[model samples]
Target: MGTDWVEEGSPSSSSVVKTKRLMEGLLLQGKNSAIQLQLLLKNSQDGSDGSGSSSEELLGKILGSFAQGLSLLGSCSESASAGHDRRVSPSSGESGESKRRLNLKDRRGPHKRSKASQTWVKVSSTGEDNHAWRKYGQKMILNSKYPRSYFRCTHKYDQGCKAAKQVQRMEDDPQMFQVTYIGVHTCWDIMKTPRMLIADPDTCVDECFPIKQELREDAKSDLTNDNVPSADFFLITGLGSSDQPNGPASVSSERMGFDDANGDHAVPTMYPFGDVANSHGLEIDSLSFDGDFSFDESEFLASDEVIELRN
Candidate 1:
């Protein structure tokens, strides 16, 4: 390296001298490697034996390695010269890096904040506004498991709305996402629904159910004022312990009304032994036959279930 230094137009004094010496050393290595290959080839020519041919092949690989090293040195020398020629212009407004940053700024355009932002809340739905949003960007958050996605009003560019939002998955629950909003939407963006057309009650009954005119008039009369039921509407079941009726009734007139098997009107059929307990297959021997009917919900349910299953 001390004897092989050649002067070149490299910028740094130390680097220029070191690079020239490095190229010379690599060139010398290549020359020596080539001489070794020539000697091996002579040995191969003397004898066509396995050992002689193997030595030639091995020497050829050594020469190839030296050639690669020389090529690397040549590249370094060219790069050094090119870098020395590259210098900042005195008359230019900015460096190449600053010009590149300006171009990038132009490409990015501008971001304007909202004029008014009064309300903010955390909600569970993506369709929070009912006003549509458009996704803009997604970036990986530092030291966080999930990436955050950015959104803005769909009318941001067209209508000049400045609203922006960032939605990110919560750390504790990956299924839940937290959204942060930056601005309020000023655009008149909303959902449109079909108008509700209500029909008159008389027309609805005429078209839907198609009731007869007489029946429709009777319905209207019944709904206009409360329809009072007759004496037959009151039924008696001997509930005498803790519960009391709204008003007392004569024992003879307090009989329950029962619908006949074949008709709709009340038939007042007499139960077996004048006691309704026998209808449930239960007989009270101690109580008289004229006693009131005692209803048991459990017994009634079980009896209905059995009858239903049998049918």
Candidate 2:
């Protein structure tokens, strides 16, 4: 999944070039891994020593390295591409490539957003043309290694807030995205409820992070065997206006619990746009999502067809 970071740069990042490099790397590593596994499996098959074969161990190491290399490749082209490697190797014959057919459909499109981009804007809710949105789909991209999810504005019926976001999984870290938000939506309700800003982080966000931790632990096993970080990494953000021209409104803080099966580490709950932007040195009070600024209710209501279609 960490490999998907490069998918953010896929438009300009040549999938052919990167895939070839990765294929060559994986082939070499895979060959070595297979050999090691074969030795270990042969030993196990012989049923000799009480110590079981280490085939699974070798295979796990090989896959982890393969995923890490792909992630590094994707991270290199983060700005130019969506970090998605969509191209299939023409050299791989159909007979042997069927099982490894590079799934390009999961790659990010030209205008899509990736979690790596790290840019988000808060929409104002005071406008009359405010729209609504709903999440439609989410998918995991192969090769580059993260899943991408889709969202569409509900106001498309009449308000036409063609806003969408492409949720790209972090190949190196399943819990993070390469998250690219595409159009600006006037929907006030888009952020009303705290949504799974990203899909299952345990299966996704923590993917690469756990691998890294394991790798680090392996390097330190000679000195210590603790499998957790020494210090916790936590980021806290607060939102609301200090000046009470309208008095202080009781604000409710939403906590998102990201579960990880690996138990490597915990990612703190990320706040919605409501509280997040304010803490990021941005003015949250000035933003609005209302859509009625340009027209009167009578005129808006007169367009019954538009209302009906939107409704």
Candidate 3:
């Protein structure tokens, strides 16, 4: 009976070995076919002769190999069960549980962030924004020349602000930076002033900065009447007083071609604060002047405009 049992086990083992060998050969064939298919696709993209027939043939072979492997796997399991009345051994059960755990781990894919909660802006300077950001981390992105810098709101811990941003220099234009902001500011240190109105330089109080008016009404009117987002407002600071002996010259609307009160002249505007539109993704023009002005960093920090929509 022992000899008979040994002979029976030998045939089962031999069949399993043959099945494994066949599976390996099929896997190798499929790998080679996939490599050839990839090369064919590359050649086609490169304007080479890409016959559809060859790719279809390779794909069919790969599918056929997979089908045969599955069929073999089913047949092997059936044969093994029929040949032996074997219970699942303790070691094999443990091994299967370990494999299941590994599969669960592998299936836990990468975490994804919602695009709706994020805002993207392209700017010339990374540090031009008024918000205080603390650099947390930097990462070298794949296929990108420059590293991306991650920043969180400075008031994150103290004030519970959830604002965060990522800054990366553009590969094509190194001078330009891509800034991505996540979440709105909920901190108390935020500027609550209304958006500034860009009137003719002649209407400006100091001749250097544009008129300061409550822009919320105009913004609402633009939305209701024109079905468009309101223009961007900037907080202009650091302009020297006209009383200063060496202060920068006062800008004139006539010189800048904004003298037309009827809005006939097309005043060319510069986006020094970047093309930050309102929260609704509406782009508004920014302020520009003809004369030079010195920017005092302290004054800029003290009187910066907190454009809510710009955030």
Candidate 4:
């Protein structure tokens, strides 16, 4: 039975081949449609409307193509599994034994293909996407100066999330990054509530004064004594100070924990209070000094004291 299935004239072999070809065709079609959709979106964003077709129509077509491709892919997987089972099913007689052995051989050398779906997007910053990613690896391409960083979902092991992405800077525009997302997030680890800064006020004082490290000890002492007012203390301890005793210090890509050597740009890591971190884009609400300061939303946003502080 297994031998018959492996034969050129066999229905199973022919069907598998046809299915594989169909899947390839569908994959190509899906890729083309995705590219077209991306172009349309870019055009729309740039305020350049196309003449003939509307974005809604093109979007509908792309969605239909993707849905059809996914259905076909699932069907192909089922067919392959069924064929494998039939080839290895228990049977009687010497021919059956031989067929089982042949099936085992086939299983050892079974055809494999990558079925993971991918999406590519160009963005100004990689960390703008709120999903926590664990950096896995980095590789330098043949003709590229910057190295591409590979990151997987932080909950990959804990929640079985299979989401992964590759981040690489564009050659022409180092400020822009090309991010390629592979696989959908299986883990529903969405952060709904806005993360609040809730740390000891003393510790906040110590961490807040990064500009002058020497002032930290005094700040901590002052915080313990309750000698300095919260607002005045923040202002005095380099919250929005433009002038520095040694030199003017500015937040660079390196300061933000980004790999400047690899052409990575600075991205805001922490958001202000009351702003829920979405999976799509980054938004900030209120500024915090080591999670100790909780000021009014208007005052926080209005003040120039809002600065990215390292934890």
TM-score of 2: 0.25
Sorted on lDDT, best first, the list reads: 3, 4, 1, 2
Best candidate according to lDDT? 3
Q: Write the per-residue lDDT of candidate 4 for residues 80-163, one digit (tens) a residue.
A: 334432234334344645676765654443443223332323344432354678998999998998899988877666544456
| 10 residues in a row with least lDDT, candidate 2 | 225-234
- Models 1 onward score TM values of 0.27, 0.25, 0.28, 0.28
Over the stretch 108-216, how does candidate 1's per-residue lDDT look in tens digits? 4333333222212232324143345799889999988999887877766554445566677767767656665554333432222111101111111111111112222
The local lDDT score (0 to 100) that residue 31 gets in candidate 3 is: 49
Q: What's the candidate order when arranged by decreasing TM-score?
A: 3, 4, 1, 2
Clashes of 4: 0
Q: How accurate is candidate 2 locally (lDDT)?
A: 0.34
**Candidate 3, residue 119: how far the Cα is off, in Å:** 1.2
Model 2: per-residue Cα lDDT over 132-189, one tens digit each: 3366898867787766666655653333333454555556655544434443332222
- In candidate 4, position 212 carries an lDDT of 18
User: Model 4: how far is 201 from its true place, Å?
Assistant: 38
